[model samples]
Target: MDIMIAAALVMRPDGRTLLVRKAGTRVFQQPGGKIDAGETAEAALCRELAEETGLRVEAGRLRGLGRFRARAANEPGRQVLADLFLLHLPDGMEIVPGAEIAEARWVDPAGAGIPLAPLTGEQILPRWVAGAFAPQQAG
Candidate 1:
């Protein structure tokens, strides 16, 4: 069975992204959680981000990056289907990790020094480096 999750590629102007390590987990990934039944992806993401990082974001601010799939990071023999979004954080916004999140860090996606979840390493970072998240020009 696959887990349905809503995740974010939380970016900063410095070109680094925010990654979170859940308590007792060695691999770091985007801050998000399983989408609850009857909950929209944007709603779930907004809630999860606040719970995990104490960063309250409006759902309308999340830019859709589409769905992504990868091997589960903490779960063996399972896959995770993630509805990913891009969030460009405002300057001076502080991240205070709470809930199940053990720690949070800013890392260069191109060469993150720590271990990463399969989804973040294999799917997210490559897309990020390839400029998939670059803002499109209108007109």
Candidate 2:
């Protein structure tokens, strides 16, 4: 079975990315959730982000990072097809874990020691580490 999800790659100024652990889940994944029927990927991501992290974001602020598929971390014999978005957040924004989120943390893309979802640990983090989606700064 394939599960469709919308995910966010939220980056900090210090080059760390945000990851969240849902309640009863050991693996941390991007802060996102399943897309509702009739919802666009960007819209779903924005809604999921706000629900999971309490961080309100405009759909326009999310840049497409491409779609990825991997074995679902929490679901047995299931694959997750994720529409990923890259978002650079302004400094000093506080994120309170909400909804299904149990905890959230900033992780160094290069050395994230905590267990991560396969989609994030394998596909997403590599792109970030290799600077495929490096943040653009206004001069």
Candidate lDDT scores, in order, read: 0.92, 0.89
CA shift of 48, model 1, Å: 0.2
- Among all windows of 10 consecutive residues in model 2, the one with the lowest summed lDDT is 130-139
Candidate 1 yields a Cα-based lDDT of 0.92
Q: For all candidates, what are the clash counts?
A: 0, 0
TM, every model: 0.95, 0.94
Q: Which candidate number would show the highest TM-score if scored against the true structure? A: 1
The superposed Cα distance between candidate 2 and the true structure at residue 30, in angstroms, equals 0.6
Please, what's the RMSD in Å of model 2?
1.8
Across residues 33-72, which tens digit of lDDT does each residue of candidate 1 receive? Answer: 9999999999999999999999999998998989999999
Model 1's TM-score against the true structure: 0.95
**What lDDT score is found at residue 2 in candidate 2?**
86
The ten-residue window of minimal lDDT in model 1 covers 130-139
What's the CA RMSD for each of the models? Answer: 1.9, 1.8
